[model samples]
Target: MNILCVCGNGIGTSVLLKVNVESVAADLGVDVNVTTSDAGSAKGTANMNDLVLTSAELAPELEGT
Candidate 1:
């Protein structure tokens, strides 16, 4: 599975989410390829990933992406 963790700048928040996602997927014994991306970049890359995770503040912008 490919999972994307997105944030405003693609640095801090996204990176943190990526780590947490990886940890939980590990605990669940699910193999996943997780990555971090910014809101703008995510818009273009979202389709390439299986899942896109982000904060509520950014959710609307990413909807249907």
Candidate 2:
């Protein structure tokens, strides 16, 4: 599974979320390829991922993606 974690800058909170997601997925024995993206660029790549994780404030921008 591919997961994309998004944040304002794509380097701070998103990176943290990526690590956590990876840990949780590992615990569950689920294989996932996780990546991070900023709100500005996420829309373009969001659909490529199986799941897109982002804050509510940024959710609207990724709608339909």
Candidate 3:
């Protein structure tokens, strides 16, 4: 699965969440291709990814996927 962790800058919060997701996926024995992206980039990239992870306030901006 391709997962995207999106945030404002794509360097801090998104990276942190990506690490946590990686840990959980490893524990669950799930192989996932996870990436981190900023808000603006996420809209362009989300279509190619299987899942988009972000805060509730930011999620609406990424709708219609």
Candidate 4:
């Protein structure tokens, strides 16, 4: 699975979330590729991702994906 973890800055919370997600995916024996991005850039870059992780405010933007 391709997962994109997004935050306002793309360097702090998004990186932390990516690490946690990878750990959980490992524990579950799931193969996943996680990437991080800022909310503004995520929409343009998320086309390759299968799932998106972001704050509630950003969720609706990804709904159509």
Query: Please, what is the whole-model Cα lDDT of each candidate in the order they appear?
Result: 0.95, 0.97, 0.94, 0.90
The C-alpha RMSD of each candidate to the native structure, in angstroms, is 0.7, 0.5, 0.7, 1.4
Which structure among the candidates has the greatest TM-score?
Answer: 2
In candidate 4, position 43 carries an lDDT of 79
Candidate 3 ranges beyond 4 A from true positions: none
TM-scores for all candidates: the values are 0.95, 0.97, 0.95, 0.87
- Model 1 error, position 25 (Å): 0.8
- Per-residue lDDT over 1-35 for candidate 1, one digit per residue giving the tens place of the 0 to 100 score: 99999999999999999999999999999999999
**Candidate 2: how many backbone clashes?**
0
| TM-score of structure candidate 2 | 0.97
How big is the positional error of residue 60 in model 1, measured in Å on the Cα after superposition? 0.9
**Decoy 4 TM-score against native:** 0.87
Worst 10 residues of 4 by lDDT: 56-65
* C-alpha RMSD between model 3 and the true structure: 0.7
List runs of model 2 lying over 4 Å from the truth. Answer: none
Q: How many Å off is the CA of 18 in candidate 1?
A: 0.6
Error of 4 at 36 (Å): 0.2
RMSD of 2: 0.5
lDDT digits (tens) for residues 7-44 of candidate 4: 98899999999999999999999999999999888978
lDDT of 4 at 25: 100
